[model samples]
Target: MKTVICLVHGAGHQPLHYKYLIDALRRHGLTVAAPPLPTSGYDDASATKTHLEDVARVREYLVPFLEQGYEAILVGHSYGGRIITQAAAGLTGEERAAAGQDGGVVALVYIAAFTEKEQPLTPEILGVPPEDVNPATKLLWPEAAIRAMYHDIEPGRANEAVALLQRQSPRDLDGAAVCKSSDVPVPKRYVACRQDRVISFGTQLQFAEAAVAKVVAELESGHSPWLRDDGIRAIVDCVLEFSRRRQDDV
Candidate 1:
């Protein structure tokens, strides 16, 4: 069997956000898993550490699956993207060398995912002033506004989504600083959102370039591409193609 696709969610969001994408991948005969992060009541620093820890936890859960002769493709969105990148970097050189043959992660698909060094999670990356980078600085999202962030979600479902929103820590904002540098040799694909208000299109392009992936697809949706049909199709198609390519290489 091919490796399953591990989906990672962004900060202030949960795995539930990727429901549409997960279902679509499943329909295409792919296994998917999306784990939640530890951002509830965390400060920026603590949240950043927790993000790495979350990556470790996910890797641990995934190891047994890999050991069982299951390969995996990691897919991350926003903060989830950052977590997946760290996880990929954390893999030892020897471990990465054994991928695709037995049970190892074969590729990484970053849906608005973050890249190390090239686009560190600094205040500048977020397009915010140093003084405004504080988590306690009051970044409030009303229930309605939060729903608006997800375009296709119905009002009823949006309310439920808002309930899952957690207060992101400022440390998470600074956490990208401590990421150890590692070359991601696995194949990668970056899905860029053209009208993303949270992370700019330019930043996504820069990240895609840094990832050194062979393909990059742009969606004219907002930050949450999963909320759009065309965006979801783009992601599903990319994963399927990447998986087939990996399988063919084997």
Candidate 2:
């Protein structure tokens, strides 16, 4: 069976963000799954709790598929990357040990995603000082920033992307602060976007280093690499190649 590639979307964004990447992976004869995450008002404590709950829920749904003889690799973008880390932490060592065979999630891929040890993703990227930053904050994408970040995307596509932005609860940011995972011995990769405004490239690199990812690639594009064919291809190819190498070693 082909290893399953489970794509987790970032905070406030839906699975639709990964449509192009998913299609490309499928074209290469890889199995892909992108699941939508729950969205609620920013700064709502209850909503934030629900968001984390939803992350676990999605993992439960995928677990059975894995048990049914399918190997899977968890791929996460932005906030979704944080969620996958939490979900993977929830699994027992035995479960992860079992999945290690066949290159199924023998590694994790984070696309401009946050790691527990990285700088906080805040709305202050607009240039406000940290002291002025609020725990319950929301950042709206400015038109100019959007253009710079997603230059490869079509105008219409970029406009549509705006609709996917959600106001994340303050708790979501808080959750990431205390998140921790035992080193499950799975290889990890971090795809950094050098021009990202939402999450600083420096922060992403720092997170990758803290997480101890085996491989790290920096893209010249913005936060959303899916809009660029080359970026998407690089990610999919990396995951596939990593999976193959793991299987061979086993």
Candidate 3:
């Protein structure tokens, strides 16, 4: 079966945010799927999106490939890690039996992501300021508005990054991870960003400690490495490496 590569971005982001990375992957003759989270397009302040909705959306995209026995490599960044965990669960051995599904996910690559389960998102988990937390779900966190997401980027690009930012409901942001780390039955890899201020190295380490990643790779990049040249290479390299290793295993 041919392998499938899908990219899911973090909160306040759409598939376009991964445009550069996608272009690079395609340049390598790789087919990439960048799914738009339903909760995205925050232009409508009246709507709210949940993590589970994105999970279901991603699962839908992977199901056809899985039913055909195609190996899938899910590359998720930031909040996307939660969706990948839930989306890939159905293709795992246990879920296969329960759902009678034919597809399989070969690997999970988390890029400076958030990997929490069954709890509300918080600054404690994300290593951000506690004041950023909106207890009433009254305010939205604009990821692009913050310089830290792509602090290393060129000046005007920051505004362009903000242009890609989505205003997310606190309800959507607070959605809990549906699947536990133990529920995900596949090789998990973590890409640590040494200079990540959003998800600090210590917090990423805390996530790794709980779930035990099979491989831990590092890059001297900020939260959004896909935005940087080296960061894009690191991400593409990590996923391709994992895919190659999986093929070799077969």
TM of each candidate vs. truth: 0.80, 0.80, 0.85
- In candidate 2, position 80 carries an lDDT of 73
Per-model C-alpha RMSD: 4.0, 4.1, 3.2
How many clashing residue pairs appear in each of the predictions shown?
Answer: 8, 1, 1
> Which residue ranges in model 2 land beyond 4 Å of their true spot?
40-51, 90-104, 117-119, 125-152, 174-182
Candidate 2, residue 197: lDDT: 68
Q: Cα lDDT of all candidates, in order?
A: 0.67, 0.66, 0.73
Q: lDDT tens string, model 1, 1-250? A: 6668888777667677678889999998888877666654334543444565667667876776776777788888876766777776635323745553357666778887676523555556566445543346223355433533554555665566666566675555444433532465567778888877567888888777776754468888777778677888999988988788767877
Residue 201 shift from truth in candidate 3, angstroms: 0.9
Candidate closest to the true structure, highest lDDT: 3
Mind giving the per-residue lDDT tens digits that candidate 2 earns over 13-89?
Answer: 66776788999988888877777665433344435454466466667666776666566677888877776766665
Candidate 3 local Cα displacement, residue 196, angstroms = 1.1
Best by the TM-score measure: 3
Worst 10 residues of 2 by lDDT: 126-135
